[model samples]
Target: MKLLTLPSFLLLFFETAILSNFVTADTNVHYLDNNEFFKFSNPRQIYGTKPLHIFCYQGKPKYIIHIWQSVILYINHSTDDYNQFDGGSPEHVEKEYLEKRYSWTSGLFSSKSKTFHLNPFNTSCIGIESQDTYSVHLKIIRVDLWNILKLVAGIVFFLSAPTLSKNTLFHYVCGVSSGVCASFLILIYFLSKLFPRKTFMYGVIGAGWTLVIYFLQILWDNMKTILSLYRTYVIWYIVITGTISFILCYRWGPVQNQRTMNLIKWSLQLLGLLLIFFSSHFQEAAMAQVILLLLFTYVPKRWVLAPKMYWKKRFPPKLKPISNDEYYEQGVRETAKALDDLRKYCSSPECNQWKTALKLKDVKRFASFIEGNSHLSDEEILEYETSIREEVTDDSDNGEDAQFSEDESS
Candidate 1:
């Protein structure tokens, strides 16, 4: 079973690799929402005689739609009533509903791009209804890469989760999630700056900053312990808790003895720290080191050498033998009192017959018997009592039969 672990992980890794490629290829399908742009290209013989329609649904509050073509063409925009022309062609749309929308005549001979801020709440489609007999290509560019990357990253992350330890996986997920969120917020912040008209961007930015500050404050609160643990385990304080460093050094280093291995590992760790300190992302590396050390120290171990060695060296303390006589006596008294209460409460003729059937004269012996059979369940005790009652009934019947025989003989 243990030998199959590596092979299983390798199989999973290959499967993930193949699936990632499959997903990337599959993203190019003709779903408007999946793509960054919706494209229209005229065929070789076909000119711009037929109208081209681009449908939009579930539109946002604002969409910066950029429409560019290979040749000059007249483009018509729909009003806010997007659903009015649901699945309707441009020719079928009423002329009265056609509003004076965005137009670019500057590049009459060459292809020019026209931008529009469209709200697709009611508008169904953007149409190019020009009757011009020229080959034309149109492209509508929107936000695509970031959204696609997020989806792909999420899929890969989820698939890879089973291969990682809980702590490592948690850190990875938190880091990726926070990094993606921060990147999105930064994008939004810049977008808000560029488009001062979007007032809600400011509120979103403020909320994002507030959450970031709150988390930073929490990190600050635990900064002391974090730093202490890192310094003690990951750096110079290697005599006790540098399990990772010790293992790596002992396994690969040329040193054979414990003292020499410790010295070599400490030196190597110091060198690593120095290199990290000089790097461009010193702060990130430092924090990551701290987190790594924290994880290493807190992770549950199956066998710890230090604890085992300490226990071995320490002498076992002498303990006096404790007697359970007091407890036994207390239990006997309680049982006797309970039986007496039961006997007094059950004063009916049937109860008296049952008591006589039991034939228990010594209450102490009965209590001892009960204590000895205390492990038996309630059902077992009831069954035992029933059997005793049956035996008493049989004995009484036999005595009556013997008395009748004696009377008959007399």
Candidate 2:
């Protein structure tokens, strides 16, 4: 009497697990809910600077360093809780940036600020409030040059790959997103060092822009369901797809000279759009999650980072399963061409009589265009030859009427 849905439920659970982030206690130095750290200051204090940290992106959950897309350590000015200077209410200032409700794009009060609280008395208001401009002394931490360079280099290498595929737009989008984030991080790094305050402001701009884009994606995804405008979405999808196509086909995909990659890029985009159109609950948040999952799961496999997953794991990365361009470059296309020819020739009158070569195995082997012997023993070849003879003889007898007319007419 047990139901059949049990296995499907288990599958969904595992799917979620693969997408979840692994967090360490050390990474989460501080854990503050909305009211605890980011609330308004007690009306008792007057003036002082406390360290304030406003984060736009958390690279991974539960990490000690608390890597962010952008971090601005503000020096808050306060009185009652002197250990930390609460940097006025930041919510007013973050109106343009704090859009991703599902994520902490606006960050939290020091979940670990208490541990790192340098100012004994002024610590309370360090990251609170937004009035005291000097109360918030912001510091932008630069991503490791190596990490930044690695992302940049990896993206370049991926693009440089003799095989660029067109089926997986998510992979390309991830590469593009990583490259952009890294480039901006680098720019902010140099700018923060040289220009200081202005650079931090610009960093805020970049961080806001990043969140904005993420939000837009979410909005689009959610709006389809929440807004109930499938027709408009279809229109939007077409416009965007068409525009992206023109850009990729005319400008980047071909000009860069990788047609396979171009095709993959376009195909994925179109498929993603179709998925967006059909799926009722599809949200930007969900799509972003899927993109991230695909990035972690699919891209590495394409790079041959490991062997393929099996049916046991459904929804496994199917991004251009094998890089068509690279395979073609590796002479897969030529082999295919030869096999096609063999298939045709085997069906012809000259070879159809012997019919040995007409078998799929023989044709495929011959089409492989490999020069050396297959190492098959004479016994093995004889066995295969016998099978082919029997099949061909039967086929010839059955089709005699069909072939007889052609021969008689000739």
Choose the strongest candidate by lDDT.
1
Which of the numbered candidates is closest to the native, going by highest TM-score?
2
Q: What lDDT does model 2 reach? A: 0.43
In model 1, the worst 10-residue window by lDDT is 66-75
lDDT of candidate 2 at residue 192, scale 0 to 100: 57
For residue 235, give model 2's deviation from the true position in Å: 9.5
Candidate 1 per-residue lDDT, tens place, 1-410, comes to 87889899998997797556434321111223322343443334344233333434333333223111011122233222111221333333322123221124322322212333232222333333332332222233344343334334433433333333233334344444444335445555776776655568767677877666655565465567677777664344333234443444445543346564455445444444443332212244434544554355456664456687677679655767646897778887998788666655454444554565478565554454444434345898899999999999999999999999999999
Give all TM-scores, in the order shown: 0.18, 0.19
Model 1 segments more than 4 A misplaced:
1-50, 53-101, 104-172, 177-390, 393-410
Backbone collision count in every prediction? 5, 49
Q: Report how far off residue 256 is in candidate 1 (Å).
A: 41
Model 1 quality (TM-score)? 0.18
